[model samples]
Target: MRKIYFIALLLLCGNLYGQGLPGLGAGTTPNNKPILHGKNWVAITGKPLGATAGAAIFHQGGNAVDAACAMIAATSTMWDVLSWGGETQALIYNPHTKKVIAINALGYAPTGATVDFFKSQGMNNPPQYGPLAATTPGTPGGIMTMLAEYGTMSLEQILKPSMELAKGYPIEAQTANAIEAQKAKIKDWPYSKKIFLPHLGKEREAPEAGEIFVQEDLYQMLSKLVEAERNALKGSKSRKEAIYAAYDRFYKGDIAKEIVRGTREQGGLFTEADLANWKVKIEEPLHVNYKGIDVYKLQEWTQGPALLQSLNILENFDLKTMGYNSANYIHTLYQAMNLAFADRDFYYGDPAYVKSPMKGLLSKEYAKARAKLIGDMNDPKITAGDPYPYQGGTNPYLDILKKNQTKVASLSPGQINSTLDEQFISDFQSGTTSMETADAEGWVVSVTPSGGWIPAVVAGNTGVGLSQRMQSFVLDENLSPYNLPEPGKRPRVTLTPSLALKDGKPLLAFAVQGGDSQDQNLLQFFLNIVEFEMDVQEGTEAPNFNSYQMQSSFGDHEIRPGAIVLRKDTPEWISKELAKKGYSLEFWNKTSGPINAIWFDWKHSTFWGGSSDYGDDYGIAW
Candidate 1:
C-alpha cells in the first residue's frame, strides 16, 4: 500500500515541479531536539564546550568567522578527534564580496614521503598510524590565514577561549575513554605518552572522566602563538600582518625546528623545510545550480565535489514524488551517490597537480549519462563513467579505468566472518569533527577540520598531535596516479563542508565528520531539506542511508560494492526489498554522521540551527 501511494505521489511531484520543492508532502518530521533559532547569531560544533567557546567569541562582538575560528581552536584543544597539528578546511560566505570562498589548509605528504619510500617498507599503503604517517601540520597556518583575510578579530582574541581550556578543563568521558582505550598505542610515542597517559602504570592510564585534564604543553604552545601576535602588534604591525607573524613563527621559526626534531626522534619524515614551504590556499569554490539553489563545494583535492555530482544527477528526477526514505527514495539516493563516488574514486585528485576534468563531472549532460547507468536493482558492478566527452576533452587515463574495472571484477563480496566488516566501517567513517557559525551581518562559515585523532605521536613538547593523514595515499598508480604520495603533494581527503545560496544570498551552512560517508550522507541531508522542506533540525536528524560501492579513502582502500547501511528502525519490508536487489545489508543505531547545519530563513531573517543527536554535537544561539 505504501509503495502504491509513493508511486502516485511521484506523479503529483512531476506536475508540481514548477511550484518548487516539498510540493508533494509538507509534513514536518519530528525530532528529539528542538530547532535552535536565532536572530543575531548561531554557533554549533562537535562538543558543548566548543559551542560555548564560539558563544564566548560572539559575546565579545566577533563575527561568524571569528567565532568559528574560536570553536575550531577550542575543539582541537579538547581533543575532539583533532589537535592543533590537524588540517583545517572551511567555506566562508563573505557578505562583503557576496562570494563563498574555499580555504584549503590540508597538509601534504612531507619530505621523504614518496611512493617508493613506503613500498620499500613493504607497505601497500602508507602506515595507517604513528610518526611515519605524519604530514606537515596545516591547522595553525589555516586558522591564521582565514582570520587574517576574512575575520574581524585579532589572533590573540580568537585563541583566548581555547587557551583557557588548554590551561584546565574537566575532561569529557568520550576523550578520556579514547585515551584509555589507546593507552598501549599512546605509550609507544614518548611525548604522546607524557601527554595522554596521566597514570601510566595504573588500570586507567588516561585521565578519568570529569578530571581536570590540563595540557600544560598545549597551553604553552598556544601562548607562543599569542605572544608572537602581541610582539608583532607592539611593533606596529597591522592586525592581519600580526596574525601572519604568528603563522610564520609556527612554520619557519623555532617552532618549526622543534616539530622536525620531535618527528625525527620518532622516525617520521617531516622536515623544517617542509613546514617552511607550506602555505594555506584560498580558492574559488566549485558550485552547481540544482533547481534554483546553488550549492558550493571544495575542489577535487577533497571528496566534496562528489556531493555536487550527486546533486547534478538527482536534478533529473522529481525526488518529492518518490517520498522521503521510502524504498524507492533510498534506492535512488544510494544509486546516485554510488555513481558519484565511483567517479570520485577514479577522477578526483589534487587539482593543482592533475587535470581532474571537473568541468565534465559537474556537467548536466554528464550527470544524465551517469544517471542512465542506474538500473532498477542494485548494481554490484557499478563503475566510473567517462566524463571527458561531455567536457570536450579526450580521455588520457582510459587504461587506468580498465585497470580498475579488472580489479573490481576480480573481487567477490568480502566474507562476513573476516575482520573486513569492522575495517570497512572504520575506514568508511574515519574520525573527524566539524563547526558551523552564522551571524546577522551575513558572515557565514562551515568547517570540517580533522586529523590528529587519538594515539597520535606528539611533535616535540608542543603538545600538538601529528596527523595520520598519510594513510589515505595509495602506493600503486593504478589505484590513483594523481594520489600517489610525493613530497609536498596532498592526498585526496574526505573532509567537506557545505554551503548553499539562492538568489545570491546564503541559504544554508552545513558540515559532517565521517570519512567516506561524509558526502554520501550529506547528499541525502540536503535533499531532505530542499526537496522535503524539513526544518534544519529535522533534516539533520533525519534517517539517511550509506552506500559503500566505491573504494574507501582510508586503510586498505578497498571497495565493498554491494554493502549498504541503514537505520536499525528501517522497516522490515525495506530491508527485504533491498536484499532482493542484491544489496548486502548492515544496520546501525544512527545512520547519519555527526552533522551540524545552520539554515538562514530569509523570510523571517533568522537562523535555524541543527546539530546531530546521534553524536555529542551541540549548538548555541543568541
Candidate 2:
C-alpha cells in the first residue's frame, strides 16, 4: 500500500507539473503571511522599523530613490546587522532613465592592506574581527553619492529618521541578545564596550529588549552630514550640489579625520587619503534576458551575476516539466547552481584591478556548454568552466586552476558531526540585511547593504562600527588570482541586489540577506514566481534548498563539496533520492535567506510585496 501510495502521488505531481511546478492555487499555497497590497508605494526590508522608515518617506512624497536612502539610513542606525560604516550596493530603476543602474559603493582595502601584509602577520586570511579587518568606510559616501545622483530629498530630510534612531530607539531582543552573546568580543574593543554594553560587568551587559539604545556620537555624526548639506543650500547650491557638499564633508573633511583617528588608534591601516580618494561608482549594471524577462545584477564585484549564469543554464531545461522540489528537479538546479558558483568563486572579482570574461560568461552558448556537463546525478567533482576560449582569449591560469581543483567528499549521515555542521553553517551563511523600496512613479530600488554587523569593533569614540569584509579576500593567488587583497581593490562580496524588467518595465525588484547563500536564494525565489507561477507571498514562503558546494565568501572561505542543505519538512522520497545521488544531505529550519521582494502587478497597476517568515523581515504598502 505504501508503494502504491508513493507511485500515485508521483503521478499526481506529474499531472501538476504538466501545468508547471506544482501550485495549489492561492489559498492552499504556503503563504505564511498575506501579500502587502499597495496601489502607490511599497517598502520591504529585513526589519520592521526599516520598512516603516521607507514607508514614511514614501508617505512624505519621496520617490523610490529617496525612500530607499531613508531606509538605508534608518536600518544602518538601527544596526540591523549593519552600520553606517558598512558598504552599500544597490540596483535602482530610475524612472527618468527608464533603465536600471548599479551602485558600487563597496569599500576598498585601506592603505597597507595586502596579501603580503596578512602573510607577514602569520595569517592566511585577514583577521575576521578587529580594526585590522576593517575596510575604508563606504556607506557614507555611497549614500551621499546615490542621493546626489538620483534622490530629490536633502540630506537633512533623508537622514531625519536615522538621526532620531541614533539618539535613542527601543532595541529589539534579537539585536540585544546578539550583543550579549558576543559580550566577550565586544569587551575586547573599549569603544564598543562603552556603548554596546551599558551595564558593564553585569550578568546581562547588553541592553534588554525594548531598552532605549542611544549613541550620542552617532547622533552627532548625522548632524554633521545634515549641517553640511544645509550650509551648501544656504550658499544657493542646487540640490545635487548640496548633496555632493555633504559627500565631500563625509569623505574629505572632519568626518574623514575622525574616522582615521578612531581607526588608527585601534591599530587599523586607514589613512585620511584613503577616505578622501574613495568614490562610489555609478555603474552600468549587467543583465541577461531569461525567457521574456530581463534580469539586471551588479557587476563582478558581487556574487549577483552567478544567478544570471545559473538562469542561462537552467533556461535550457523545461523546469516546469520537472516539478518543484522533486528529486530530479532538485538535483538539476543544484548542479546548475554549482556550475555557476564554481565560476563565481574563481572569476568574479574587482574588474578594475583584474579582467573578467563576463562577455563570455553570460553568453547563452557558454551556458549551453555548461549545461551539457550535468549528468543524471550530482557532479561532486565540478570545477570552474573556462570562458577564455568563448571570449577569444588564451587561458592564463589553466595550470594553476588544474592544480587547485577542490576535492569533493560524499559523506553519509553518520559521518557528519553535529558540532562541525554548526560551525560549517556559521561560516557559510554569515549575516547581512536587505532593503527594498518602490514608489508610484515607477522607480524601484533593491539594496543589499552589509558588513559592520553587531559585535563590531567600534572605531574609537566615533561610535561607527568598522566592516569585517577584509576576511573575504584570499591570501593565495592560486585560490583566486583576481581576488587577492590589495591596498585599493574591492573584495568580491556576497551582497547582491536584483531587479527584473518585463517588456522594458519594472517586473520585480528583490534582494536578500545571507552571506554566500544570497544569489542561491534569490535565484530560486525568482524561479518560484516566473517558473512555478506562485504569487509573491507564496513564493516568499516557498521551501527552497541551498547548495554549499562553493567556497564561502566569509570566514576562512571554506568549501563543503557535495553538501546540500534542505528544509526539515522536505519529502522523504526526495531526500532519500538525493542521498542516493551522492549528496551529503542536511536538514535546516529555513533553507533560504530572509528574502524580500516586490512584484509589480502591471495589469492592475499596483504593487505586491513579499517578506519571508524565516526572520524579522517586514513589509508595508500604501
Candidate 3:
C-alpha cells in the first residue's frame, strides 16, 4: 500500500492538470533574450537585458559558457549596483570534465599594502583610496580564464552582444531607480554622470517597458577590446598576451589613467602597478556531500564555506520527515543556520592571510556536534556552541581577541578596550552595504559583481572615481603577542553560487543576490523545492526569513536580535508559530536578491527555467 501511494504521488506530480502541487508555467522567448527554452539546456538571470544578451549568444551557436560571458558583459553595463568591473566569483560545472571548478574573480589587496602602512602615515581611518584600497581587478582575468578552459566561443564573439547593447539599450525602471538612488554621488563623477544622465542636464529615466537606452563610451570600450583581439590574432601576439593587452587598455591605458587621476585628486591610493599586478586566482572548489550527492561551493574567502557548514548541520535531520515549512522544520533550519553563521563570523576569512579550518568546520563530525545542541521541542532565543578551534594549535578564541585589538587601533585607540566605545558607535554609523547554478549544456550562469566603498579615490581621465574595495576590511583591535598589528581580514562574504545534482547528474542550479542573505536564501530555496517538493516558481516565490543573531558584515553584533523578517506572502500560521518561538517578526514588501534557476526533467529529457518575478525582469531562450 505504501509503494502504491508513492507511485500515485509521482503520477500526480507529472500531470500538470492533475490535483498536484503548483508548478512553474512554461514559456519561450527569442534567443536575443537570455531565456533558452530548449529540451537539453536553459539559462536565467535577474535582468532581461542580461538574459537577452546571453540568449543572443546561445542563438549564435555559443554554448552555455559563452552565453554566461555575454550575460556578464551586458550586466556590467546595465546593473550599475552589481558592476562587472568590480569583482566577480563563479562556479562552473563542466559535463565534459564531469568536474566542478570555482573561479575567484575577486581582487586581492596590493602587495605594498600592510596594516602598519596606514598607521605609519598617521591615517587613523585609511581613506578608501590609493594603492591600499585597490586590489587587482579580477573580472577580466576570471572571464578569460573560464573561456580559455571551458568556453567554446572566442572573446570577440562572446563580448559582441554586450558591446552592441552598450551602444544603446533601453534603460528600465529598475536601472533608473538605482541611478536615482545614487544620483548625488554619481553627479560628482563626470564620466558616470555623462554616460548615465540624459542630455539637457536631466537624469535619465527608465524607458517605459519598450524604450531603448544606450551607453556610447561603454560600447567604445567593448569595441576596442574586440579590435585589439582581432589585431592580436593577425599579429604575433599570443592569445594570452592579446587578452592581457585588452585588460591593460581598460585599466592602465587612457581609461585607467583617468581613474587614477580622479582617485589621487580625491586623496585616494591606487597606482598603475596595482592594476598591472592584479590577477584572478583559480582555486579548487570546496565540496560537501549532502543526502548522498556531492555539492560544490567556492572557498572561504567567499561565504561558500558557510553554506557547506549549514548543509552539514542540517544533514543530521531528515528534512522530509520534519515536514516542509512546518514550524518544526523552520526551527531546525534556523538553529542550523545560527550555528553555521557563528562559525562563519569567527573563522572564515581570506585563506591567504588567515588560517581558516574549513575542513573541520564542514566535517560531518563537527556538524553532528553542533546539531546535538538543538532542541527538537522549542526554538531558543539564542543558540550557543563552543568555539571550534583552528588546526596547527591555534585557538580561535585567542584569535578573536587579537582581531578585536587590531581593529580597535584602526578605528580608535580606546575602542579596543571597551565594546561600547564611542568608536564602535561611529563605526556602526559608517556601515554601507545572483543565482543560477546551471551547467554549460544550456548554461544557467549567475554572476554578481559588487563595487566596494563609495567615493573611490581613483580618478579617471574623464574624472570618474573608480571602485574602492579596500573598505571591505575590518580592523582588528588585538595585536599579536609579537607586537605586529593585526590586519582585520575580509569578513565572511555572503556571495555564493551553488549547483545541486542528483545521482551524479545536474538536476537544478540556483543562486540569490542579497548581501549576507545569499546563502540563507539559497538554502531556503533548495529546501522549499527538494524537501518540500514545491515547483520552481513556488519555491522561488515563497516568503523567506533571515536571522541577524549571528555576525554579519552589517548590523548590530552583540545583541543577536532574534529578528525574523518575513515577506508579505508568509502564511499567517507560520508567522504565528515563529512569534510564539520568541522570534521578533518584521515584514518587508519584498526583498532584493533576484533568484534565477534552471531544472532538468530527467524522464522527459527536457529543460525548464524561471526568473524571479520579484523584479521587473523576464527570462528568455531559443
Candidate 4:
C-alpha cells in the first residue's frame, strides 16, 4: 500500500517542475521539476549555477570526473557557503575498472602544530578563528590530482567557468544573507572584508541578491594556474604534466610562498615546508555490507565509518516491518546511531596515527553484540562497546579511554578560555557545499567542498583561504594517538561522502554538508531509499531527526546526553511518546541535513537525481 502511494506521489512530484522548497528562496522557477532523468550525463550541486557549469562541461566533451571538478570550482566561486581556499573529500567510482576510490583531500596540520607549540603559546585547544586555526589547504592539490589521473581535461579548461564566475556573477538572496551574517567576521579580517564586503564609494556593505559581485583578486589567483598550465604545455609536456605544473604553482610556487609569508606575519605557524609537504591521500574506502549492498564512505579520518556502523546495527532488524519513521522505527534508528556514534567517538580517527580495527568494527558479530546493549528504554549515557573482544583483537585505545573517559572535561579548556575572546564568538559558523556527477559510462563522483570562511584569516593577498581543521583536534596531554594536536596529523573531520554499489556495479553517489549531523542525515536518507523505496527527491525532502548523544567533532567535543531533536514536521505524537521513553525531545524546522544524491539504474540505462530543498541545491541532466 505504501509503495503504491509513493508511486502516486512521485507522479504528483513530476508536475511540480523545478519548484524550490517553501521559504528557501524558491524564486519563480518552474515547479514541475521532479527527479531529473538523463541518458548520457548528469550533474547536481548545492547551487544551480554550479550544476549548470558542470553539465556544460560534460556536454563539452568532458567525462564525469571532469564535470565534477568543474562543478566544485564553480561552487567555490559563489563564495556563500564554500570557498576556494577550503578543502574537500570525495568518493569516486569507476565502473570500467570496478573500483571505488576514496580521496582524503582534507588539509593537514602544519609542521609546527605540535602539542608543545600550543602549550608554549599558553593555549589548551586550537583557536576557533584567525590564522592560528589555519592548515595547509588541500583543495587545489585534490582537484589537480583528480584532473591529472581520471579526468580528460586540462586545469585551464575545467576552471574556466569558475574564473568567469569569480570575475562577477549575480548574487542570490541566500548568498547575500550569508554574507550579511558574516559581516562582523569579514570586518575583522581586512582581506576577507576587501573580497566579500565591497566598498561602493562612500559606504561598504554585503552584496544584494541581484547585484553583480566581482572577485578580481580571486580571478587573478585562479588565472595564475591557467597561465602555469599553458606555460607547461609549451613544448613536450603531457596533459598530466601541465596539470602538475598548475598544482605546483599553488602548493610550491608563488602561491605557497605568499601563504607562508602571510600566515607567519599574522602569528600563524604555517611555513613553506608545510605547504610543500602536504599531499592528498587516495585510500581504499571503509565499507560495510548492508542488506546485500556494499556501502562505502570517506574512511576513518572522518565520521564515515559511523554511517557504516549504524547501518550494520540497523541491518539486524526488519525495518520494513517497523514501518518508515514510525515510533518504533525512530527509536531503533536512534539506538543504532547512538551506538555507532559512541564507537565513532571512542575509535574513529586517522588510521595512519591510530590503530582503528576496521574489520572488527564493521563485523556483523560485533554489530549484533553492540545492538544487544540497546535496551527497551532509551539510553542517555554515551556508552561505547567493545568490538575487540568479539574480533579477538586487543583494544588499542584502552589506556587512554580509561584515563580520559571520566575526566574528559564537559568543555575543552580552549572553549572555556576563549569564551570572552571576541575572535571566538558563540554565533560563528562555517559551511560546506556538496557536488555529485555521473555519466552513462559508469563513473560517479561525490565531492564535498569546504573551508575558507570569514572566520578564518586569508593567506595574504594571494586570495587563497586556509582551513581551521586544526580546531577539531583534541588538545589534552593524555598521550592518546587519536584526537591529539600533532604535526602532519589529519583531524577527525566531519566531511563524510558516500557511495553504494549493488552486485559490484556502482548505483548511488551522494553526500551532504552538515558538521555534526552529516551521518544522521545520510542514515535517514539511505533508509528512505533502501527500505521505504522513496525516490531521490522525496527521500531528501522527508522529515529528518538528529540525535546529540555523542561527542561533537568540532570545538570542545561537547556531549549532551539523551537529547534527540526531530524536525517540526514530524508528528507531534511521536515526539511526545519518545519523550516519555526517557528521551529528551525538541523540535526544529531544519537540523538534520540538506543532502544531495544521484541514483543510477544501470539496467535501464538512465539516471535519477535528487537535491535537498533546504538550500539552493539544483539537479540537472543531459
Which is the winner by TM-score between candidate 2 and candidate 3?
2
Q: Mind giving the per-residue lDDT tens digits that candidate 2 earns over 235-349?
A: 9999999989988988899988998998898889999999988889999999999999999999999999999999999999988877877788888999999999999988989
Clashing pairs in 2: none
Which tens-of-lDDT digit does each residue in 1-622 have in candidate 4? 9999998675444223111123222222332347788889889988889998998898889999999999888887786465766788899998778999988788888878887888788877787677878767878888899889899998989999999898899988888767777678767777777777774343437887889988887788899999999999995799999999989999899988988887887778887888788898988998888888899997888888999999989878887766666667788888899889878877777778776777888898999888887776776654666678777888766776665555543545333221122222121223577888998787899988777755557777877766777877877735235667677888887788899999998767888877768888899898877876667777777777777777666666666666677777666666777777777677767754568888887778898888877767888887
Misplaced by over 4 Å in model 3 are 1-37, 110-135, 199-214, 236-241, 251-258, 376-393, 396-446, 452-459, 462-465, 477-492, 554-560
State TM-scores per candidate: 0.95, 0.95, 0.80, 0.90
Candidate 2 weakest lDDT stretch, 10 residues: 411-420
Which ranges in model 1 have alpha carbons more than 4 Å from their true place? 1-28, 406-420
The clash tally of candidate 4 reads 7
Q: Name the best candidate (by TM-score).
A: 2
Q: Per-residue CA lDDT of candidate 3, range 1-622, in tens?
A: 9999999775543322122232333221122223335564455665766777777877777777777777766666665344444567787777766666777777655444556776777654334434355554555666666666667677888887777776677776756665555556656555555555564245443234335766666566567667876777788877666765666676667666655565556445556665665666667889788877676788887767777888888988987765555566777877788788766665666876666677677778878898887875333333333344422345545655555535433653232221233433332222111535343363444455554333232244332224445544444432121111223333334567787777877777777666666778778877766665665665666556665555444332332345556676655777788778766676777644566677777777666675665664456644
lDDT of each: 0.87, 0.87, 0.60, 0.77
Which order, best to worst by lDDT?
A: 1, 2, 4, 3
Report lDDT (Cα) of residue 419, candidate 1: 26
So what's the TM-score on candidate 4?
0.90
- Steric clash count of candidate 3: 43
Q: In candidate 3, what residue range of length 10 has the lowest lDDT sum? A: 477-486
Write candidate 1's Cα lDDT for 223-304 as tens digits. Answer: 8999999999999999999999999999998888899999999999888899999989999999999999999999899999
